[model samples]
Target: MMSTSFLHPCLRRMLSDRGGNFGIMTAIMAPVLLGAAGLAIDYSNMALSQRQLQESTDSAALAAATALASGKVADEAAAKTLAKDFVVGQMTNYAGTASASAIRNATNVDITTSTSSTSKSYSVTVATSYRLGLTPFMNLLGHSTIDISTTSSTTSGTSQTRSALSMELVLDQSGSMGYDTNTCAQYKKNGTTCKTYVVKIDALKQASASLFDALDKADPQHTLVRTGVISYSNGLLRDWTNKVTSVSAMDWGTTKSRDYVTTLSPDGGTDATEPMQLADDTIKKNANSTDAESVAHQKKGNSKVDRFIILMTDGEMTGNSNTWNKDKDQSVRDKCDAAKTDGITLFTVAFMAPDKGKSLLQYCASPGGNYYEAETMEKLVADFESIAQTATKAATLLTN
Candidate 1:
């Protein structure tokens, strides 16, 4: 309370001696500041590690469950091996290339697999310790590590299985399909230069082959997949007619559909109505057939058949043979609508098609994410593969 001027010189010297105050304060508060910084850094690392662990376990569990659902893994031991392999494979980013040793040292991994008459399930738990980077403060606190863990489970089998799929692929083989594109190579025929062109048909063949391969992979047992091929130009080709073949019965082990595609030669005009109607009729007949497969599926209480018509074309509808007074484009749309009304899902692809063709196909496709436009052959193939995977329900993700 006394004024500064009234204080004695010695008292003033003692009160104003602040040369070492900063060092004293730092010395006193250094541990708290460093401890806070260390906690922030270590906690961030722990969060990252936990996220990565969850991702790995989730992927492993889903993969193992899919294998079981598809009958790729026969028993519990095989399922466990698959899950562990997947988990270790996914954790490679965390442990470098030595993930095998990391997985071995992980004490918190528990894999449990169970199967019932109608379903199979895989549960995976991964718990491991991440050594904190040795910050001087954390080391001084004797806290040099943090633990991270995650658990994920997935189930699949007959109960979870989608109904048997009947996919009718209606591909366009018009004269434009024979036109040269850069996607395919031109070959010499009978010592002639064969025009040295890569036709759109060649791209279609390659893409169709890839699509069939994906379908084969999706249906390993082949009991749940049946495919019918219909190639159309001015009219539907009878060669690949109402012949619906099971995945197992195809010439190739799983890719027999490729044979039908490979044999097709393009040489006619474009018409969408005939091929669309043919595909629709084929799917309806097969879906409602009194065959053993349909009866068995009906008996299982899953009477809903998954019917799909994948119509791909490279040109506008030009002919009017099968249409009833409706324009070519309107006729195609009407058929597509009827097919949809009959519980058949439609996927329409416009590959290097004109604006008119693209618009018509867009109208024909199912409302939600069923229309695709591919300006290039590569994109066409990728789209087909994606559709095949979706149709077979091969890709599954864990939500929780």
Candidate 2:
């Protein structure tokens, strides 16, 4: 046992003092806390620089690759030069002139290009060492900067995986299509009495022609699209019966289809069942047949064939006195369901149609945005143009 009573008085007093202990501890830890803060700041700066570098590299790669894919750059040497230029330009935009210059001076950009029979590709790899803004703590730890690198690649060509389109246009030539409209008129002779009637069918013909024009413009070479026409009154017209034609077969320089449309006269009751059935039959035959034109246009291969039917009518479905014996509307609906089940997309247009007609078209169309109703002649044209654009746009497929 040690006795406190025997200790020296001055020594005991010093041991018992605890008033300045906190101040002493703070003084010892101050350097450590400050160093930690400095390291944190330096780490944040490094992270920001790394992100900037990554973004710049990615943008440069995309720009160069797009050019290569589009055939803007002829060969590998040109592509490499283009990629380097893009990187320098992008870095300059990301940082200031001084930083960009420093990065450019330190960086090495390598671009590799390869080509196959069907496609061209470009890959860009950017390597550089980034000089960090050093903190005193980081300097003490012997770390001033880090190296960052990134690689990106892109390819472009006519994709053999893309689907080709085969579209059938089934138009109504019902008596109602001859009704007066404010936008267009046609003259008809009845026993020397020439009557001028503003006709919906005339507007339909013009709009349909515009659609074909758009298709031609989208596919100038006539290699991607094929079309068939079936105009129906009481039944499919004998003149246009099974009149399916490919773009390659048609003379692109002439308006042969449009001219054929101009000769169509509106008569007889509207029966949509026959037209829908005919479209279904045509698409099915095109899909599986060994005929030369069918094999060239619609045959299954590495690519697929997209079958579509565009049904346009201005009146409700009426039972054909010559053919249909059951409920006409129900018969049409049944055929529509069968078409969809067979993977044939349907685009239904009702031009100034009654409620029954609109509802039927809506049901017949492929659900979710396939049905279009045009209240006027102008709208009919716009609808056809929109459909044409959609079909053409969907034909292009981009892959990475």
Candidate 3:
């Protein structure tokens, strides 16, 4: 205030005396220079606050959509509240400048839904604003504060759910599966003759185990996935002996194919007709059973379960005579066609099989199905793991 009263003297001194001009110019430009420097610093702070708001908004949208999609929160009102709470909670670091109530009041959460014949998807959009503090020199020009707003959105169908699955893994445990591959990595070992020689049986166990791991990762709670494994040799006989699939007996860890590959060498032939028939029928039976997993999925409003059959083999169908084997293979083909017609996706693997076995597996595989012919043990494992990843959409997880 006193400096304002002396402006005339300073101006008169600035013009009349060159010796005092530097001090006069400095006094004249000090406010402008400080305001410019403050603006530059405030710009950096504004960028950081905007980034925080955008990140919080993105996280809130994703959380809201996932909760809605996974049946955790069903209604629009609850989802919006969930989103608001999440946004306010995530931006606690920014609360040093703005109160939680201010952030909550500045945020707007909205949701929209899209439903087709089979699936429903929910999208959440979150828009939030943060008031950033400006420097005192800038504020003196009537620019007290600035408001920055950011918005983000996400959809729930692909983001949250893997689409419920009911899969029957029909695997071959015939004598030929006991033969060794070139490379040896031992899950089962001999005293010192070195390794157990990395047989096809061992490879099947590892591959099927990897498939289990993938499915588990995708559906950790076991609410959306129902998997059954059926191993066969010579007929409907599961020569591995310890496992069976039913509504009451669905334990993936206990009945895992990985733990049950020791009896393949003694099992004589590969007759997939009866086992293929059983696999297809089991899927239908479970879907219709009131006590089955479909009932539990229904309670969660995910009753539309997709069906899959993963058929694997090391040799073609065999029987009493060579001619009879062709008829048995025909029956297996019939089962494949019927299963596909019933909306069951079929993935087939021929593990170093001869031409006939490969041809059968290729034919059994649905159109647009994943069919693999793996010569090495590693390829076999990769193929099974790929099938599980593709089916469960494990590669594209978003907050699930």
Candidate 4:
């Protein structure tokens, strides 16, 4: 690496060097390669921002639809306000390329209703378009900003058919979660400090908090949504068990799970079996009693209640060597199978993990959007929010 990297300096160095054509090429292409890499990073950031926008839109659409179905939104104007407000709130909570004011201004919401003899339906659409600023590399290329837009639609059927949900977040709080995801030196400050880097645990906490908030917007009364969190490193930290529910159906709402995640101090080796089993049991017990989760929804005439488990990990199962443990890995898979057999939906995330961990998460996932492999902290946050958005759409997703 050259200390002075201007083109003139590189040419001068290349000419005087006995390293010859190869060194000259290396010196010349070095800047171009670095510039190209920077541009790629900018494009990747743009992609993540757009994806976050889409997810926020999706959540907005669902929240508006739920409000309409629950009679909280009286008319089309109210629906629009609800949708815009929800999305703006989410964007405020989770920073994106587009500012909250910009996102709110660019967003559009449309609602249409249909009524049959015994049923009512409301179709809601949410869309947003904004200009995202790019990095200096893109500016040098004469592209300073990119226009991005996203749209999502949801339909709310009769209240009697809309289902409720009981969700559990099984998080891995192994020592690795305390590590940082900032790889490129260009994005760092002069001094290396705790405040300068993005830790994986902090990223999870933020993403999980956003997920809870979006769900709250969908079910403000907490009657239709109940979420819980349980983390395991070497095993479940006994001291933190009382803070969040491990084997309860109606324990988490907007703040309970967030509180637990916010205080997570990741340490020790990774052992995820115990918590995953507890989570599976806590939410799956609904099958015996028609789902205690569906009780409030049932009072509102709902008959279905879906169960979800969001399992996230940064490493494969651990053994004495602290690397891979096949038997324990299978045990986790067995728990996944048991939960899925009980009709529980699983959303698995492998964040900054090795191939073995990714493979394990892929196996635990329920196919399609259920599996997320986040190589960056930004993607991890987006993936968790996506999970929350997708879950709420179950009762309202329309194909026709």
- lDDT, each prediction: 0.71, 0.72, 0.76, 0.79
Ranking by TM-score: 2, 4, 3, 1
Give the clashing pairs for model 1: 181-198
**Tens digits of per-residue lDDT for model 3 on 1-400?**
3458668888888788768678999999998898888889889989988888899999999989988888788688899999999888888766653578899998899899987634578889999998777888788567879999999999885344445777888888777787887656554455445455787887888888888888887766666777776777776553266444212223333244434443334256777777777777767534354746466557656646677889999888885333337877888899899888777889999998888889989999977758888999889989988998878873234443
Off-target runs (Cα >4 Å) in candidate 1 are 1-112, 116-118, 122-159, 184-197, 238-256, 285-303, 320-326, 394-400
Alpha-carbon deviation at 187 in model 1, angstroms: 12
- Give lDDT for model 3: 0.76
Looking at candidate 4, the ten consecutive residues that score lowest on lDDT are 243-252
Clashes of 4: 0
lDDT of 4 at 327: 85
Per-model TM-score, in order, reads 0.54, 0.61, 0.56, 0.56
Candidate number of the best lDDT: 4
Q: Which stretches of candidate 2 lie over 4 Å from their true place?
A: 1-161, 184-197, 239-256, 285-294, 298-302, 320-326
Assess candidate 1 and give its TM-score to the true structure: 0.54
Candidate 4 lDDT (Cα, whole model)?
A: 0.79
lDDT: which is higher, 1 or 2? 2
How far off is residue 275 in model 1, in Å? 1.9
True-structure Cα RMSD, model 1: 15.7
Q: Whose TM-score is higher: candidate 1's or candidate 3's? A: 3
